[model samples]
Target: MQRSPNLANSVSPTNIGHVVFGIGGSTSTWGNRKSYAESWWKPNATRGFVFFETIPRKHLPWSISSPPFRVSENTSKYKDYDKHPIPQAIRLARIISETFDLENKGVRWYVLGDDDTVFFINNLVDVLARYDHDEYLYIGMNSECHSSNSLHSFEMAFGGAGYAFSYPLAKALVTNLDVCLKRYQTLYGHDHILQSCVADMGVSITHEKGFHQIDLHNDISGYLSAHPQSPLVSLHHLDAVDPIFPSMDRKESLNHLMKSSKVDESRLLQHIICYHNPTNWTFSISWGYSLQIYESLIFPSILHKPLQTFTPWTKVIRPPYFIFNTRIPSNDPCQAPHLFYFDSHIENTTRGGDYILTTYTRGKIRGLPACNHSADDISKIVVFSPIRKHHLNGSRRECCDVLRIIGRDAAELKLRDCLENEILP
Candidate 1:
């Protein structure tokens, strides 16, 4: 694959994103969906961004800061589309179908994502840099692999996983929008509808692993740890997985992905370096930096080079950490299924800033499509800890914790249990 000439000196990918939320008449529906689009998607939006596109309504509480623009639905043409499920697909298709008409806006790529979907702008651009924006490219990953032989095509990209139309493809779709809309209605799903339209335009779906549909039931540790040697483009099903470490909702996951990719800056969890120790499906754990992966049945098949911040387009995957159910009893901090070295003695700790820890079992929670899965093919568990303020200079004995037993794993891990009684708020 050749690099886009446009990316010669550029630091980020060129993307103009438009987020669509399936409509609803209920105030709560509109409000919840609006909160996600505004609060979650608004901050990280790209240059040619268009915020909340809903049908025109009376006085609604809609506002955003400078830079990325916002678009209210009522002001748009598809405003009258019903809040019903079926019509929502038609409305989304119509909105997408009309995007290219606004060409010459210097947008190399036009992204189509749902309200729940989260985009990793930098990684997205890096991934897009590998392809020419002028090419008729429809880039995204497939729907959940479990639901097969259904209306959705295995080859087509899923909407929630987030699919994008390159400039040329967007232009092509605009020219035949109505015809395509009439050809495939909501019964096929908006994603499928877009796929069929592109197929007719002589466009084939180009698959990428990073764009996640997130159709599983629970525990993204399996997915994240074993994520392909590719930049994570987008993720959906925000309301599913429990938060790990610092955040309480999907935003934390988004923050996690962004920070891991160096998108956002936080003194804590910064530059997490992993070392690939040979073991079963295990790849590697953070080298002596608090976290460790242990227990296994397979010969450490994971081998990953250290991740660099300014990684080149050549690097394919993230630091690898294969997830498995089999356990081993190695006390070597590195070999424990998961070990957290917290300096209970706070004064001696070198890593500055407050310490917080949040966690979830690798494969317990359920999600969107409801995958009836049993295998513990987990990648890594995210720990979202509640913060407790305390002067670290005065401390006690350091304590180390590892997930070697079942009590800590099966407790449906909650935010309350993780917090001390004094810090309860």
Candidate 2:
């Protein structure tokens, strides 16, 4: 029998160098989708390939900015794959085994995703650090849309959002994958096939809130504005949703978000709730995404739930649309929160320490009325945040203080570690 793969013996903590990516794509779609991959891919630093159905004859020289490309092992020889409705599922599923075959030295995990998937590399590294790579672990999250879950197994990680396997699990899974593919030939998607194979080994998905399947469509601003208290790992299905920030196309919007992420990836899209007791104003900051300023003092519990501003992936399925709790979006202008989109960031070095100031410019929503004149003049929000390490477990959500209005047009807020007994008023 072949010996088990040796685990890395280094005493240092797991870093980006320890992981490799296996991105699934097709030549037909690569031209448009490659931009998404390039946005997050580090050319020389990141390891792995974008496995295409076949390389294009016309697109001769591949750009250096994107991940290198490779053609997946042809599955037509496998008679069992013919039974699957989507023939491409077989090729996509095989990416796992093919990536493992590369045998990158010192690799502890194999992350799989689609061409459209954008990974936050720093956050991804931090998340993978939480698990023991030597163990048989499957880590990822399910879809946001409940109907999609009803159609597909909720236990399975959605491939578009991406998922990871500890080295040992991937090694073992690939050994039995061919048989599993043949056995589960009726499965609709590659993710399901892999999930079926992983289940046979008695492993379940370790859900991480940060990995977004983005099963919902239309303006996802509401969902993103109230992110769960976790470091964002990946975002998929950019083509399905509207531009994250208004006035920009999908690629430009992604580039814009990356600006703040470059400064501090740990804080990107991490939610923080603060209040101005004097004006009874509520501020919901989805760091690096958008900020919503409410006219009333919304309770922390209520503010934490996402506002259902987008439609479900499948209209065929009925009520209770999303898996998580979502408050009905208000039509009343007075109740609607004033919107502000991230515009730019400024990094500062002081004798005390280093901090980042991200600016969010107000977006004019046609019917949104100013509930309070106190906040009417504010056109921008400048947030002061000191860099801190992101810990996935047993760590309290950082709190923020609404500082004095800097000018008639700009609002300032400062972030700080919460007092043990502190509660938002």
Q: TM-score per candidate, in order?
A: 0.58, 0.94
For all candidates, what are the clash counts? 37, 0
Error of 2 at 115 (Å): 0.5
User: What Cα-based lDDT does every candidate model obtain?
Assistant: 0.45, 0.85
Residue range 26-86, candidate 2, lDDT tens digits: 8898888988999999977899988988776556688899888888887777764554356
Candidate 1 ranges with C-alpha deviation above 4 Å: 1-30, 33-59, 65-85, 244-283, 286-292, 296-336, 339-425
Model 1: how far residue 174 lies from native, Å: 0.7
The global Cα lDDT (0 to 1) of model 1 is 0.45
In model 2, the worst 10-residue window by lDDT is 1-10
Q: What is the Cα-based TM-score of model 2?
A: 0.94
